[model samples]
Target: MSGANEEPDIPDLPAADPLPRSRWRMQLVWLVPIVAILIGGWLAVKAVMERGENITISFKTGEGLEAGKTRLKFKDVDIGVVETVMLAPDHKHVLAKAEVARDVAGLLVDNTRFWVVRPRISGGTVSGLGTLLSGSYVDVDVGNAAKARRDFVGLEEPPVFASDVPGREFILKSAGLGSLDVGSPVYFRRLQVGQIASYQLDPDGKGVTLKVFVNAPYDRFVKTDTRFWHASGFNMAFDSNGVRIETQSIVSVIVGGIAFESPPDSVEEADAAANTQFELYPTRTDAMKQHDRIIDKYVVNFADSVRGLVVGAPVDFRGIEIGRVTAIHTRFDAQRHSFSIPVEIEIYPERFTSRYQDGRTGGRISDDPRGIANYLVDNGFRFQLRNGNLLTGQLYLALDYFPDAARAKINWDKSPPELPAVPRTLQSLQDSVTRLLVKLNSIPFEGLGNDARTTLRTANALLSQLDTEVVPRAHDTLTSAQTMLDSANTALQPDSALQQSTADAMQELTRTAASLRTLADYLSRHPEALVRGKSGDKP
Candidate 1:
């Protein structure tokens, strides 16, 4: 479609220079795609280089796991991803196949722990809250095994401690679990220093064995003789002193816990070895009770009602507790036709030796127990029921010297060596009061009262007669006496003639006394005055 009007150039146009040949032959527009290809190749090599190992984890459930969504994390750092979630051949477990980064290859060991982390609340701790927002992830705890592993069984729950956490574990054998759980705290002197790791019932099903882990410095406190006890609930006790409530901590009361202590005075062979076995006492009192080396069994036959006495009641020597009641039994006497209560007791003979320490009854009994018993019995050493707590009415067997006690003997033939016991002082007081009450009840009070009432009635009638009859005569006599008194009063008036006459008579009597005294004195002067009465010239 070219027009024919163009004229030919005079020089033939130099053959239309074919797009000038140059060293930079590529087009500017094509350069962009070539550079992009180079970058893409480098990225492909990087992806192959950074790829991680593939691992299969078996979980009890596939919850919170999703293919290509759930990530494998070490300390919350994404290291891999789950490629598939499926069931195992047995269909009992979920298998999560994942790929972890090559950098963490060393962590894929035989003992490595893996678990799915979601929002969990347990043992008073709330964890994995972040997972609620971001989603659950497969968390790994690096292991330190010499061999590597590709397949793993995820933990039913998270591991309580990291493998590198420094601590030791101990085994506690108990008759029962006693409100214990895996994460129950462990205490040393009321300070939380550890937790329960695991537990299993004994093969014989007679007890449970619990494993407890104590963190570093506290683990050193465990000793061969260390005592463990259930410090779960608040220990409440009421005694003669007062009510007492004791607990390791408020948390322990709610969650349950275990406590351990090496007696302050105890000597240990060494810090208990790892996995050392120990016994768990039911209470701190039992755990702290001193172990007795030697024990003696004896029975006391009491005549008084035991009332408040029970098994485990203290058996006291003077004021010191040397034994405890173990059993209480009753016996019927055939000939006497009476029932007697026999209390079986356990006496720690060590308490009687010099090695054992006590303020009262220290080394009072000899090592030769039989001979000592005989001698003590002869010297009025007797067992008697005594009131331990007056308000509680608790009775206890007491060994004391009763100087006036009746003679008695120990029946060694008895299996437990029967020791005679006397009634408590309260029982004696009760008996005396009963006898006095019986005597008072027998008194003829009604007859005596009737006689007294009859006598009172007779006296009342006599008094009535006096008031109606004899009283009038008495009043008449009183009136006559009153009239005479009035007359005498009138006659004895100060200005009356009778008073004047009385005064005159007193003056005459005085004058007569004076004359008599003068006469007497003159006679003394003159012995012949009587014969010469006319010679009194002083008149």
Candidate 2:
């Protein structure tokens, strides 16, 4: 019976030849993981593409830059990472391989500069790490300047600001540059508007070419008549009366700066003509024209004019500093017997014209040169000496204003007189001393020595009379007088025995004479009494 029931089991296996599975089952099994892997790979490829940029940077110092750890940023946003670092063949620089994200590609302009922005201190500002880290680099600025596509170099300092701000370029020539320095502020009426960008030697190497930047609105203030000067450092001074301008602070930041001085009365003219045509010159051009209409009526050689004037002397027109002598050099003039000296001078004609001009007046000297000429004529336009520093004998040219009557006639036919020149300051005193020695050589020292010898002889004779003849005679006379006084004192003594004896002898003589007179009276009748009385008296 159980076999009969179980018979169906064999039949059941054959009956279920049922629905056949699809042939694509094996393919489906293989496809799931493959699809997933493909998707994952595509995503990864996209990520890499988005995160990558190929770039190379050169560095002189690799102190803080690190491979794989360093990042490139655009406006504080991380855009790339340093992939590799290799030393250049010359070992002078390090080449940094970096990969930047594709999103930031457009921001890399032709002028884009890639510099390692590390922490630094400048102009009282602390940047980059903010004292948090030492060696980390921040993406610094590259000027929008066009450059070739190649490896970029990192700068040590980040630029303070964009350059080529619309303005005029002024050129200043100086011997020592005084207190002028780069990054010094430029002030207009004591308000800062610009700064010194950079400096270099002029092409001729005779002067310095300063690249100064003047910002926006203030740039317009610089005009054809604008005057620039150095305003820096301490200039403490005092007069003989003890009144002084003393500097008491050291931390003070009165740094070197530039200033503009314009004619006060021409304010309206300057404003109106501020938009006139102008040009940018890397160096100062001799564009200022002299009053050509006025002929060079008198051409006086510098040496002749200053022959008698010392270095610190005044070249005055009624005691005014029309100009200053910057330097003096000699060149032989074959045509003439003397050497022609070229004297470089600087003049400030502001005060001379400032008082006479008004807002409507154009900046022309010819308009009112009569006053200047008259002043010069009245003052004799002469040179006089002045002491820049008493101790150093440093001299400077000063302008002295004097009445016409006090003026001395200058002889143009004769050579200029040789004048004493002092140092301009203590530092230049050595130069004055050197020149003084040269002039001192011309003094008659031999004659002075002879005069000194004669004076010594007279002094010696007077001393000898006082010491030997006069002193000895006074001593002998005093001794003789002392001796006579001593003898008189002894004779006047009341207790002397000789004095008592003399008194007694006088009494005896008186008694004897009385007795002789009495005997004479008795012998009146006879003369025999006188002789007899004397003989009896002796017995």
* Model 2 / residue 6 / CA error / Å: 15
How close is every model to the real structure, measured as TM-score?
0.58, 0.51
lDDT tens readout by residue for model 1, 1-539: 35578776686455665676888788889989999999999999998998889999999999999999999988778989999999999999999999988988888999999989998866666788998789999889999898999999998778777778899999999999988888889999999999988889999999999999999988998988999999998999999989999999988988899999977657565889999999999999889887666788999888778889989999899787889999999999999999999899998876765544453323335657888888889898888887788899888889998898899898999898998777778788899999999999999999999999999999999999999999999999999999999999999899999999999999999999999999889789887767656473554
TM-score of 2: 0.51
Q: Which residue runs does candidate 2 get wrong by more than 4 Å?
A: 1-26, 123-125, 129-131, 142-150, 162-229, 237-299, 302-314, 324-539
For every model shown, the clashing-pair count is: 0, 29
Candidate 1, poorest ten consecutive residues by summed lDDT = 355-364
- Give me the runs in candidate 1 sitting further than 4 Å from their true place: 1-61, 65-114, 138-154, 173-180, 199-209, 229-257, 280-286, 331-338, 354-367, 406-415, 431-539
Give the Cα lDDT of each candidate.
Answer: 0.88, 0.57
Worst 10 residues of 2 by lDDT: 282-291
Best by TM-score: 1
The alpha-carbon deviation from the true structure for residue 271 of candidate 1, after best TM-score superposition, in angstroms, is: 1.6
